[model samples]
Target: MKQKAWAIHFIYAGIFLLLAGGQMYAVESFQLTPSATKFLAHNVGPGPDTPRGALNHLMVNSGADVRETIRPPGWIAWAALSAGAVMAAHGGLLIARKK
Candidate 1:
């Protein structure tokens, strides 16, 4: 029973570490600048300008602004990754202990 618990612990720890690593890497690689929107039209397409088109553009731009504002600091990512590593190590220790 103890061995089985330890094995499970190690498995969970490994998964956590993998997730943390990926998240940290993604944040590190992310750009702070907002990218150009390929889907949004600068002006009303072919037809006359309508309130709907203006509203759509406004919504898209606002969403982009929110995303840009909400990015986590690099240090935060490092801290999260560190926590994940610690959890993984603790789980490994559990696995190594005999019943």
Candidate 2:
């Protein structure tokens, strides 16, 4: 009974990690709309050449529909996917061994 519980826990953890990795992998690029830009500027505070200033500058100079493109690095997604796969496989092996 204790071993089964442990296996179940591992499986659940693996599933969560896998889902997170998949979501991370799916987003190659995204755009932040004008409103989102403004929100960020407000929260990020002001500076001459910082992110907040950049966002503010965009809001002031660009059209209302203009947006900022954000691209996260590829390695982060790959790392998550690799880690999640390893976790999930380890969990599956734990479950199988119990049975």
Q: Which pairs of residues have clashing backbones in candidate 2?
A: none
Question: Which runs in model 2 stand beyond 4 Å of their true positions?
Answer: 1-27, 44-63
lDDT by residue (tens digit), candidate 1, 4-63: 686677668766766876687686454334343314334423222678666556655675
| Candidate 2 local Cα displacement, residue 66, angstroms | 4.2
lDDT of 2 by residue, 1-99 (tens): 787777677777777777876776898787887778666655654863888587676664565665657787878777777777777777778878877
Which predicted model would earn the best TM-score? 2
Each prediction's Cα lDDT score? 0.59, 0.72
Model 2 scores a TM of: 0.53
Clashes of each: 0, 0
Error of 1 at 32 (Å): 14
What's the true lDDT of residue 81 in model 1? 69
**Cα TM-score of candidate 1:** 0.44
